[model samples]
Target: MLPLLPLPHLNREFDYLVPAEFDEAAAVGVRVRVRFAGRLVDGFIVGRVAASDHPGKLGYLERVVSAERVLTPEIVDLVAAVAHRYAGTRADVLRLAVPPRHAKVEAEPVVDPPKIAAPEVDLDAWASYTHGAAFLDAVAAGRNPRAAWQVLPGEDWPARIAELAGTCAASGRSALVVVPDQRDLDRVAAACEAVNGTDSVVALSAGLGPAKRYRRWLSALRREVSIVVGTRSAVFAPVRNLGLIVLWDDGDDGYAEPRSPYPHAREIALLRAHGIGCSAVLAGHARTAEAEALVDAGWAHDLLAPRAVVRERQPHVVALADSDHALARDPGARAARLPAIAFDAARNALKNGLGVLVQVPRGGYVPSLACGKCRNPARCRRCNGPLALPSAPGADGAGTPTCRWCGIADANHRCTVCGSRTLRAVVIGAHRTAEELGRAFPGVPVHTSGGATVLDSVASGASLVISTVGAEPSTPGGYGAALLLDGWALLGRADLRAAEETLRRWMTAGALVRAGADGGRVVVVAESEIPTVQALVRWDPVGHARAQLDERIEVGFPPAVHVAAVDGSSAAIAALVEEAALPDGVEILGPVDLPEGQRHPAGGGSGRDDGFDGDVQRLLLRVSRGSGAALARALADAQAVRSARKNTESVRVQVDPIRIG
Candidate 1:
């Protein structure tokens, strides 16, 4: 029995003895029910000890939650470390480690997978993966212990994923692969089913019917098959003998588990693998700075195709500048930020017999409006409602506009910043862009992407399709030319990782362009070529990330320096930050207010701000690299002090947030 004399004020872990009957059940990595404070609570079976110092009064394990060991030794220890750093509960972290109960399998036995040869594949993915078989062989064998494989894009991605699943099956270990969205998950699921007909391969998504999803989850745990593929939450899947973990587009926000103790899929997968010593891969078309950092730090290896093996030929991308001093300007393209060169490119592509893809800003008709002179979005003085073009036709055939936030009419309203009656569109949404495209190409069939109507539309071959970044259609022969409009909005996002996010979005959309249109052209709308543009220009993401990392190190960012975020009311956040322990290495930034109208629900608070509930905001705490773990330890200490308050308030601890400000 554990010693209960020194009662920890905190509801923390207590060491206890294993009852004789439950001795076998008390082994490490198992789950157990425990009696605590006159209530039954769940606790992880961290260990089974021979003896304990506490008296006979010490409580016994109520029951084993599961007959099978849910956590590996590595995960148990990793969770402990995580708990210490983030001041998180072991139970909460365990919830992340174990996939949902429905996703857990129990009865079925794993079966041997059939042998498969190196694929005689066809894919023109850009990553210099020209030497196809060699890359496939390396990935199949799990040759690299630290890193997983990234298949060069093309039709072979699906085939390669199945092949990897087969290898996991052969190893007698279950596998899990994560993608950015449900659509990709469906594609992967279909591909896996074609190769392995059993229930072993299933996709877990809340969008699917509860019963059906639960069935798939159970099948995976039972080793009904040996692999599970899905979005973020799939990382928690409790597959047995996990041999491999794969994350596609690790950089995408979709992988960030946005909940209590928000755990990212990549970090979770890495932790799980470290716990079990399993092999894994961090793969994507273009690597992010974080991924590149991993490769550079020797934490993961880069599995790439030869320059000739993959999609070496790219769309002829041109960077267009649109200042007052442009040599040529197209009258039709003057609306929005469409440069004449981009319009000319699209015109040529259509005339030359290839379809063109026009990328726009927002999906709605009028996302925002502004004064033509001041460039300020027209908003109601009483409320911050954005004035936008209404769906209904205007009185005289022109569309009427209204404010979405406050439902205020803007049909006769003039610009607030400038007194001019004539208002110009500050941000041309997807609908506006489609309208412009329709007007420009009168005879061409103009399809729009984004929002409800467009996202639901089935993919059809079109000559001119206008779409938002993610909603770009997957056209046959691809678009002859792709134009990324409204470069300012993308580059001007208020988020800290704006540049990184913009680049990723652009690259993902750009990948859809056909390789042969006007020699395959992609026109970027930018003044000067930024780093992201340069990376796209040279297709050197690896180098791009490396450079970014070097800059981060020089200027203290994650993977270089340690940082923690304390989010709450102004007083609460400030109190915690002040009380936080510092071993002379950590630094703090910003009790600063969050970006206007952008604070997270947990991120904001009302500090009696002029009698209105306003944001409490967040502060960034930075620590020296040497004391990275110590910084986390400090935050835990601070959290303890704040928890003892009579006035209960929420204080959040995040170890490494994806978004850095």
Candidate 2:
């Protein structure tokens, strides 16, 4: 029996007796219960042997959990491969592959799939893109191809994705399209419905009820859907005769799984394509450094558009520091939250009966609170938590400071460094921006969108819409003007991807503004010379990503080299690193302690600058790309040895972590 237990010591299968009553249900892939460790536990039946292999008598299975053959052989192999590659346990990967079984859903009726023929469109529709037709034709002819696409602005990307999916379906092959989230999936699903019928595609997501999710999963397994569109987990959808896989907006953090092994959606999609010998397309508005690495390694072709065409389609972006020279003489321009140019643009847009969009860094009133005198961040004395102002204004029109981690009020607290009781907002949020804009533009309506009450789109009107990054809503005719605030908060992050991620976020919101020829303007309040700001102004995300990749290669950072992170107690991490026999060209860095504090998305880590914790430390291992497999095996062996010895120390191994910090 294939035991479900994931303990490192009991990873392999064992022999078990099948009673006569349960013989009919003892099929491969069926879950069964057996007596293990003096109690009943679930296990899968992988194979039936003619005779017992063990020398001694074996124990009988407690009972058959279900008769459904849910674990397919192909999926089992994929799970095993992922576990080995990440130095993780097979059972952990299996948990991500299959969800809890719902017996009642097994009897539900399958919906009949809609029948619709693929539609033919003009190849000129891909005019802005380079070699677009070649990629599509290759997929249509069932030629296994791979590409990394840098999508241009103002392009009908969803329609193009649908065209590709329809081409595969017309060739008698199934396709999978994985986007970042449900909203993006909805957009692609609509485009697919226009090309193929609504019934030809099915969506799989964990957001649905257990019964509904299971029903959709079963449909895909039964080959009832020709096209599947979903978020990360859909990479494993059992599409019969799979021929193509597409990953959209690969740079979005939503594509990164937070669970054990932490397999990225893009990597999983790449693995599926390579294993099944199918076409794969990785497309994003602002490509990531990792994608550029694939192109450098000759694993995928570079798909790009000409600079002239891109500039023409992009909005006229200007940095305040470059456009307003006289303001620098005022001595206060460096400290001004909103520059004069940005304020003027918003005022003019309102006067013309046009909408204005303001993109803030944080979501609430004040995500970071600091002392007014010393500029040191305020913290809770009880738990050492970073203090934040209440999301809403207080009864007296003042802000109340509260610990973000421990949820304790500290309105009367004083700064330990400078003994100042007055607190100021170090990083402003959407609510505060709305309050300021409402007062600045009197009689104009001010709408806010962020958190759980985010709006999809706003109607055309002479108003101001304040939203945080990634929460900016669409306008009917596009916003007449946009103001990108708090550029320092995004650029000052200590993480490696801070600049790249900031550019991506800025471009995503900037793309919503009307073109410059149509009287639309974008004003970024930041230093003009910064690489990220310059990239946004010139609309050159691909160039910036290429430069970033080159830097990483020179410094032996990730993508150029394979990296793994081990986190736990300092002793445990150090022990694991020393015990593992890493391959040549592999090096270890750091046993540094991670700050224990409440982490905010926009701002940097929250805590005292001098605070230190010695309990938990993180260690990173780097190896050449070719020696990655050897490193994985060595780490796994080390873990096995430790487990066998019943070591009290616990360590968590993660390959290709999203953030090294």
Candidate 3:
């Protein structure tokens, strides 16, 4: 019988002897139902054995899931290495490697895939691709552009991408392309279909129904499809003769799995490509330091467009930093979504038949509020809470909003600083932006892109679109102007990556600016000259990443040191820290309390600087990477030993966490 374990559980893999009664059912890579400690569990056969590890008798293998093996030898080996590197169990890594049994077992009708079947065919699907055909051809031939590349300025990208997909189809090899999210998948998938034709491609995503997902997965493993495109988890799609691996937005946090081992798609791509020696491209308008590191190490060539091409495509972005550049800028443009100058710009663009994209601080109607007199926010009388918007509309055709913490109304709100009750909204959301623009532009249809909505809502016309970061809407006619607002929202975060991250966001929003006859107007409000701002103004993300790395190297931050986070109750955290067998040279940033205050995203960890408990625990541990595998191993060993002790489970260990204060 198979060993019993929880869903996605690691630390256990059962060994079952093939029973003479059903020897046909047992084979490497086949899923079998097994009797675990107290219950039936689903598990794959990593190996079949004649003898049992346990002295007692072993049970017969359960029914086989399928005859064809899905866990290819190459992938299993990769899992082994990952298990060792992350100091995790085999099951943990495979949880990511293998699809959920439910998602697979319950099947659905397979859609006919599109084909630009030959990777070398250039069908002009990618809008406005200048050298897109040539670039696609080169990538298919396993060549990388030695120069910088730019996103061609229009709708032809589909044809360009389809023309290139021909390369994969030609070699009778399969391919997997991973983007940051579902929207990108849609954009690329359409292009793949247009160029490749029908039945030649399939999309693998968690978004699909389980049964249908499993069918596609099984088909891919059996080499039925030549191209598989998806988000992060698709990294493990079972494509046969894997030929090409393409990843866009490598720096996106969405690509990082929140589960154990926290394996990132980028790391997986690098390893997968190396294992198969397939042609690979890590492409995005912005570059990550990790990608730059790959370039520095001679792993991949830097695909780029010429400087003139970049200049022509991207607007002449300028930073508006007052001497110090409120460098502390708000992202939502709360003070005024349309400051006179920016509003005027938008008006001009729209009147001229150009679409405009307005980025807001948050996605909802009201994310934050404060008192005008004292700049203190109103709170709920029932609970020590900040206010929030409700889901249903109020009497005024607006949704009801309330405080998430201590659920209460702001009818009796007050400003503690001045002992006054006059409170004003401090932050603006996408909904508010839409509302305001609807009134300001009068009859200019405004759409929104955020949360679960796809980018398709945005149409090809001179309409206004309000968006938040990742969900920026795409325009068919393309945007004539884009308002990148609330610089502080991007800059003021306490995390180290705040500036770098914010800059990337601004550039991403700004990238949608229309290609003007001359250089277009891309006015960024953050103070100029700050590295991140400069990178935006100059369109130099690569340089920005490198410069940021240099700072990290100097300060011994990540990329220079290995890091981990242990957060929990004060006693539990203290106990773990005291008992931890942490390696030497480890630095602890805090035993300091996380906010025990009212609930809110900003309240993740309350501030003692203001009014917050200091007893709640959170701390950062950093060790030099120069220590090599030995150190990582030792640390993981320590974490594991401590973690296995049963006391550590209460305190989470996040290796290489992105959200650190």
Candidate 4:
């Protein structure tokens, strides 16, 4: 029986004796209860043998949880392969593969799937690219081909992907699509419905309730759908006769798993294709270093539209630097403030009876606050979190300060640097931008889209729509003008992919503007000479990513070398490193101690940090591509030893963590 427990020491199947009374119910792929470690635990029946290989007495199957075989042989093998690749236990992979079983749904009769018919579509978008038609033809013929696509903005990518899926389905095969978020899934699902009917595609995401998600999962497992569209976790969807796999926006942080082993969705997609001999497509607006490496290695085709079509489809871009001589005389061109150029562009767009788009760096009423007088960052007195101003002022004649990190209200925040009592915004948010724009254009309708209130599309009427990055909505006729504000907040990030990510965000917002022929204009509020700004003005994301890739390869960082991040107590980390059998030429960075106050929960701001924990140390392991598998195996072995030795301290291991800094 494959033990359901995730203990590192028991990472494989164990022998179990089937009792005579339960002979009829004992079968492979069914859930069974067994005696493990002196306690009753659940396990999956993986295999059966007539003779026992061990001289020791085998544990008896305590009871059968279910007679239905939930796991397929293909899924079992895929789970094992994933566990091996990520240096994780098989049970951990299974946890991600299968959802909790719902008894009521399992008891229901399996009805015949509804009829699904394919629809005709215009393949002009694919034909516009150099080798796009050939790639689609290969997919239709069931030839396993790989492509790396740089999807142009406003390109109906969903419809294109659905056409590809339909082609594969017509050839008697299935497809799996893994995107970054639910918004992308909605778009993909709708497009797939247009091609392969509503019942042909099944959508899976964490947003669904337990019962609903499991029901959809079961439908996919039962081979009731030809295509599966979902977020990160759906990379492991068990599709029969899988032909094509699509990984969209691998550069997005949402593709990285935050749990143990921390496998990436891109890696999983590659693994699935390799293991099943299926065709795969890695697509995004901007190329990632990893995807570039694949193209360099001659494993995937570089898919893109012709230069003439690309230039025609893109809007004209302008870069407004902070050091412009005109800005010195203009009092409002501060780092966190808008400039006259932006104001003029908005006014012009509104006068033209077209919508204007303003992209802020963040959300909330005030995401980052500072002292009004000294311009020093404000912090909460209780938790040392960055302080922010609430939507309104308090009764004490000052704005109420709140912690953006811990959500603690600090009405009496005093800046430590300059001893100032008044608060001010260091970074303007979507709401504040909307408030300012509303007043700037009196009687003009101002709309805000961010966080939970993000809109999918907006009308192209004469108005202003303020949004944060990744939340910019589509307009009916496209916005006449766009303002990318607080560029430093994005470009100045202390991350390796800062420049690349900043350019991607800017291009995403710029793409929403109408074409140059339609009088579309985009004003980026950043340094004009910066490479990112230059790339934006030239509309060259592919070149920017290539430069970024060259820099990384020169420095022996990611894409160029395999990296793993380990964080834990100093002793635990030391033990893990000492026991690891890293290959030759493997480099180890510092085991630097991180600031306790800066260490919030893993994902984002959850609560207050009292700094009670002594200190957390982190180490980075870098090895060449040839030694990556060796390093992962050594880490897994070391973890197994630690588990066997009963080490108390817990260490977190993440392979290719999204933010290396």
For TM-score, the strongest prediction is 4
Worst 10 residues of 2 by lDDT: 600-609
TM-score of each: 0.84, 0.92, 0.84, 0.94
Model 3 lDDT tens row, 372-400: 68787766657767776643346774554
Worst 10 residues of 3 by lDDT: 599-608
- Looking at candidate 2, what is the lDDT of residue 425? 85
Per-residue accuracy of model 1 over 211-247 as CA lDDT, tens digit each: 5665666666555667788887777676666777788
Model 4 TM-score, all chains together: 0.94
User: RMSD to native for every prediction?
Assistant: 4.9, 3.7, 5.6, 2.9
Runs in model 2 lying further than 4 Å from the true structure:
15-25, 47-63, 111-116, 120-122, 323-333, 396-398, 597-614
Candidate 1 global TM-score: 0.84
Error at 474, model 3, angstroms:
1.5
C-alpha lDDT of residue 157 in model 3: 42
Q: Which rank order by lDDT, best down to worst?
A: 4, 2, 1, 3
Superposed Cα RMSD, model 4: 2.9
**Cα lDDT of model 2 by residue, 388-463, tens digit:** 8767666884677889888888778899999988888899989988998898989998999888878777889888
lDDT of 2: 0.81
lDDT of model 2 at residue 196? 81
Consecutive 10-residue window with the lowest summed lDDT within model 1: 1-10
Local distance difference test, each candidate: 0.65, 0.81, 0.65, 0.81
lDDT of 2 at 237: 81
Query: For model 4, what is the C-alpha lDDT against the true structure?
Result: 0.81
> Over the full model, what C-alpha lDDT does candidate 1 score relative to the true structure?
0.65
